[model samples]
Target chain A: MSREAADGRAGTTVGPGPGTGTGQGTGTRGRTAVAPARARHLRTRLGLIVLGSLLVAVVGTVVLVDQLFGRAQRASLVDLLERDLQRVQALVAAGTLGADFVEQGAGGVRLQFVSNAGVVLLAPDATDPIPLAPTPVRSVTGERAELVGSAAWLLPSGLEIGTIRMALDVTEADADRATLRLSLLFAGGLLALVAGALAWVLVSGALRPLADLARQAVAVDPARPRLARYRGPEDEVAELARALNVALEAIAERQQAERDALAEVAHELAAPLTVVAGELRQLASAHPDDPRVRAAREAADELLHTSQDLLTLARGELDRAPDLSVVDLAAVARGVVDAYPGVTFATDGADGRVFAQPDRLRQVARNLVRNAVQAAGAERVRVAVEGGAEVRLRVEDDGPGMTPEALARVFDRYVSGRAGGVGVGLTVARRIVASFDGRIEARSEPGRGTVFEVTLPGWSSQVEGESAEA
Target chain B: MLVVEDDARLRGLVREALEATGHRVTAVGTGGDALLRAVDGGIDLVLLDLNLPDVDGIEVARRLHADGEVPIVMLTARGDVASRVEGLYAGAADYVTKPFELQELLARVHVRLRERGAGEGAIERAGLRLQTDVRTLWAGDAQVTLPEREAELLRLLLTHPGRVFSREDLEARLYGDDLPDSNTVEVFVYQLRRRIRALGVADPIRTVRGKGYTVL
Candidate 1:
């Protein structure tokens, strides 16, 4: 259901329901939809950015070119007008007057010339002076002259031959400007399309790494512990990947540790439970009067304890220390040693005392000693301690030592050198030690002896306040 | 009768409980030692804790199963579905997740024993075959007919062929919950011996020194 929801949210086209189509609704198809939809959305955003940038660039270039061309064409039209006016003035100065020149013009300039003495010289029509009412009337006196609008300028002849007036309208210039405007618009539109295409390529390239990282994030599984290759500077995405990898590593380590712990816990609990069931059955049936019933019951209790330890471990609950007091290490070791007469045991410590729950400490100490005895198969075991702000206790045995692997996980829950131990002992011991902010270490090699060391900070000092006698 | 456990108090309690249940038991702490003892000692069944100090409980179960079809009941502290399934797959006949009720364990023990009994023939030494489940006996093809007391005595002897049954064993099987006296079993055994000898077997039941009687 969650997978279906994820697929739906990604906006991939839904096909026929499961097992409904010959090929469309297969596993591969269903899986393919999600990523493609996600990719499509990402691509859409990239396309938009590329297209927008292209539009702005193309439009800006077209506007700039149109303004420059318009100004240049305007300037050239004015120059042509000035040169045509000079030619007309020269023709008048040469005294070359013809009826044809007044009737029809040689050039495409409409003209009417008049004398300053109130005499009309020439006109396309014999209208009187055509009154320079709308156009400017200037005396062509200087060699160089300027006109404000369409104006007639008088040359400096003093003949009073008057000015030849002509006006030119730029109808062809307007048509050419219109054509240039259309071409510029068309080119700008085309350029925008091309730019958009180019931008799509560049932007997608920039986001390619991010897209790949997303794919990796989707695929990575903590249980499998596949590390992803991260690239880029100290960017947010890179940091995210690094953080994810760290979290993944932790999860992988924890999962592995749990699996190993479970295996050991199973081993530890099975033996006695088997024995208890076996013995109980036999006693109930064939040996109701047998005195050995008592011993069988005791074994049953141990199985129960082992089960409890496993339960605690599974729940991640730490066991509580019961007998709170100052415990003399030597005395506790002596008692355990004396209890197991078949196994010789000794203690060598700086007479350090530890403030702790006595029973819990004893449990820790006993488990260590017992583990050593079981490994060594020796009749003798030794306990040693060192004093200071931190107190260290060591249990050594002349037993077959441990392999490196065993030593590494010796403190793990349900680990046992011998076959029948409920593996929870060492696990419980480690938990107890940790509760007191202490450390436990083991040193061993195969076929030699093994030593267990435990160190607790200020243990001896704390012990002085909580005396054993009290 | 070996008790394998690491907890001192729990071991003591278990021993007490089994004693109360009226069986002899020896307690050990680990799986390796338990296996050794199981091999050497004639233990009828093993109440195994899956979490042992040395060997994994499933491995122990496999070994114990391979050694013989000894009934193994796993005690798991973890009550997860996977663990129980795994235990069964690994050869545990039954699983009891802790902390189990004492009565439940006793009941399981009874069930395992009873199931074991159903698998084997009731009559041990004699060619007579008996079915404990249906309570029927056959000598050859036909059903064997015998006096009630004689049939009862034969039934007990058949279940344990090599086992030597004292006079007290007969009283426990024949008598109700209470015992009249130790001598009562002697009389019954003697009469049972006579009835068998009279059938021309010439005393299939043998008397041992100190111990009472044997089918061998």
Candidate 2:
């Protein structure tokens, strides 16, 4: 079976552009936006918690105050009724229970005397008399009723006096409690609203520095890297900003050092190879028919090619941006195929335009074809370009394919199937393709042919127009 | 032409190659020397290396460009795209990375000189002659008048012979910065080859697979 058919195209797939997954925190803006949103969410949650606890406390306090005040007021009302009863008893004993007594008892209290045979003796005031039961003790009864306290006494003439019940009006106390309830509810609700507003304002104001730090962090560009110095107070937010700035500084320094070292190494390696190649070319020209000279020239060329590959590998995916220009992939493939006349390389595509550096794209195409040719052995290598939303270049070789283990790590550095292969070609190719917002993948099966596919974002006229406007 | 390179051996080879191609060459080891020699009024072109001992080569190219319109070609070991773009922005006419074929470098120099209209001559290869001044192609005893672009393409192909020119290279040469389309070069090559074949001579232009058209 074909590699693609057997494997169902299971290969390493890399997406276009920089960040692929959501919430990966890849870009500076992504990270900055996430930080503020999370902080605000946390602050709002904490504020609601505080407001909830405050409301609970207020409700508890109102209930407790209402209970204590109700008990004290009721007790005082009972005492007043007791004092009135004593006065009434004295009047009865002095035989002065007449119109004057009635007039004095009309102050929010009603007095009534009942006989033991269920007949009323004397009823003071125009209010209803209190219900009396024959009992030899003082008692408070009729909660929220006009008659609140009652008592029974025995006369000095050895005649059994009926119970003397004094009724006290509770309308004023009831009205006061209703007013207290309304005022407490109104005050508690207003306090809750004010507390919530206050918390919102304070929390947002406190988090202003964090928002500022986020904005600053977003504005930090790697191309022109500037430290995110926080000028605010030395609080947690400021400290966080300072720490980020320190980390950025350290990272920038390390990257700068790495770039410098790579450039130095590339220059050092390229210089000697250039000198050697130039000398070899001169020698070859001087002795045009010398086989030894021709061999030396070939060796020099191979050495130069390998050194260039090494430089590309060492440079990796950093140090430079691809020189974006409109390039025809078919043309680049043709150029690479021209170098290998012995191989049966076929290219089929129309005009596949992409934005890329010409030289780098040429290097990538050349490397892939070279690898394919070597892998195909004596068979043919086919390079086909399909252009649509994305331009896909597929290089298929008809030879013994790789094992699953080899296919898994085919693009890795220093991992090669062929003897004496430096193994940096595919690694460099992948890096170059990725730099162009493209990717490279390989699919193969043991004893079958291998196919390496490179996909790049296609160039559009609309994008060209937009860029030209910019 | 004035060549600026820090390395002695590469400079010697470059000097020999240019002299072999029948061009007067002046070699300098420093950017300062290059600047001094560039303004001496007899220099037709400047071949500058990016790395110099005394002053930076990009600075020299900028100064030379500021002085006049003498086309500058940067010769450097730095093959990165950024360096190439930087050299161009610094006013270099072309860029050639190190370990490049001597024939390619010579071809680029000849093209630059031809674009400047410094020398008018006929380039001959494989019994085909391209006269730059009169814009004519002579295939053995048969001759044909050519269009301006066709003559320019023929001249470039004859100058380089077997060197491959990508579409971008050809477009840049033909239209300067105003690119027309991707297939423009292919069409021009096809028309030129047809016109030469109509002159009762065999077509000398061969398409280098995947690279470009070349006359071998």
Candidate 3:
């Protein structure tokens, strides 16, 4: 049966039901869901940084432009008012200055004349005379007329005419300056908006290759051990990919070396073991009735068993998935029970077929049954199978159970509770079950019996249907 | 027989064990040497070790298989299923893991040789002798001429004495793809036992409850 069918059957069997909730629900646990990746994560970060810098630059330029324009406009307006005063003085020296002349000569410029003797010499049409405290020529020569709200100047007639004052309105220039400020503010805001968007687009475009590289890295399968070469240009992103590829290559090589070492060790161990076992058997045959020889043979068998268990435990550390197939769990349990003849094992259930590697599952069954037999001492060990969407195989033994502390670490490697126990059997069993996406749990109390329940995905009609569809 | 094993002590033990069983043995330490010895011919069986110091044992087995129908049995320290499958697919007739029972190994060797038609011409066990050449059974002073199928069945049982053979196993062996009725094996066993009893010999064929039969 297909794995999916087995999983579906298991899911249905473990579904909620009365009396099924023992406070430890397998349904709510052990399912790992991978969250989806946010596609624009890198782009958002890069865009934010680019937009922030563009805004600062746009605002700074606008403020600097406004200040420079205001200063230059003020200085030029003052210079124009000073030039108007000179034209009015020239007209008076020609003896052609009058009310009519003053009004026509000032063309859109507000002009006024006042005498140093407090007498008004000329004024614009229907306009009052300008109020001025005429400064001495000595003080006036060093200081240029300043434009304070409006431009003003003081002048002296040739040794006989009283000093005349000239003034001009700067309202039109001020209005022009205000219009320039408003336009700059509006243009600067608009430019900032466009520039911020442009920066976001440009930054996202530039980071696309990096994002692609990240995706490739995520897609790499460490188990397959292939180089993760970046196909982009030789930039920083490519450099990062190259470095990661080198690390991966190193890891693969190290793993290969470790596998070779393990194989070598296994062979080295097996060769001597074979020789010892063969010689012992031969000796036992020569003197079949000798207790010492029999004991020696048993010791050799124990050594072989321990060695094999150690090898299995080491293999479990490698964490490779087992080759799965449809297996009969009842048959496996029966075989294991049969191996231990004196143990009373009662198996009652339907043919519990599951998707598992038969040999590995057999190992798990053997380990569990052996432990149960050992724990029960001279008592009976009962093995039962409950067939449903999932097959639950239970091994119970009525003997001195473990303490709370010991029970907690029963599956831990090298933590033996009994004398001569290898302590790796349960660890290996747990690893095997987990490889098939199954679970093994234990319950025990001091002076009470211990129970080990192994739950595996069972093969059923629904699984068959799914497999057929596939 | 040719034995290819790198360990000198193991090679010596295997040679001694097989020679003690009355079979001549040619022992080699390397795959190259094994190949050379095998190519010399007159070898009925090969006991090959997978972890040879020189060329791989699998390659040697393949080359030997290419040469002839000589059966090859792998004896190695590698007990994993993958290696066992690889060895079998590479033309090995049987696989025996390291630290195995000497008796089991010998039994496998005997079976392989028998399958190759190089078995003992006559097997004698428990005061009964069945001669393959003459197709006759001798019980002390009495003798009987048996049918060909009965003689073949007795030979198979006597060779692997005390080993149980289920009815299905016997059926597969005797009939191959052309299976008769399910009780055909039972009738044959019944007739063989009655005929042997009439010859003044105690019946050696034992019926295992729920299983099939065995001769101890």
What is the lDDT of every predicted structure here?
0.58, 0.71, 0.67
Interface RMSD of each: 23.4, 10.2, 12.6
TM-scores of all models? 0.38, 0.66, 0.55
**Which pairs, if any, clash in model 2?**
A334-B209, A334-B210, A334-B211, A335-B210, A335-B211
Per-residue lDDT tens digits of candidate 3, residues A1-470?
22233233211122222212111233223221121133366566666666677667766876788789877776676566556566666666656666786667444454555554656656643254443523311112123232322122233344444545554555555577778777876787677667767766876666666666555555443333557656656777778878878888897688667656765676678768767878887898899999999789867755765666666643323233323345788888887777676765555566587666565677788788878888886356777777777888888777787776777677766787789887878777776776555678777767766777798766542242111212
Docking quality (DockQ) for each candidate: 0.03, 0.14, 0.13
lDDT of 1 by residue, B1-216 (tens): 456556554466566677788868777778898888888857767777776779887777777766865667776666444555456555565566556545566666666666556445555346555554455555456554465666666665554443444454455446534558667666666665554544444445555333345453
- What's the TM for model 3? 0.55
lDDT for residue A464 in candidate 1, whole number 0-100: 20
CA displacement after TM-score superposition, residue B18 of candidate 1 (Å): 6.0
- Candidate 1 residue-wise lDDT, A368-388, digit = tens: 766776676546566666666
Instruction: Provide the global lDDT of candidate 3 against the true structure.
Output: 0.67
- Candidate 3 deviation (Cα RMSD): 15.6
Give the C-alpha miss distance for residue A380 in model 3, angstroms.
Answer: 9.4
lDDT of 3 at A74: 62
Candidate 3 residue lDDT tens string, B1-216: 999999998898889999999999999999999988887999999999998889998888889887976889998766565675566556676777675556667878997897567335778887898888888999998999888778878987787654555676576556644668979998888788888888987788766444456665
lDDT tens per residue, model 2, B135-195: 8778778888899988888876776543445566677556654568778897898788778
| Consecutive 10-residue window with the lowest summed lDDT within model 2 chain A | A461-470
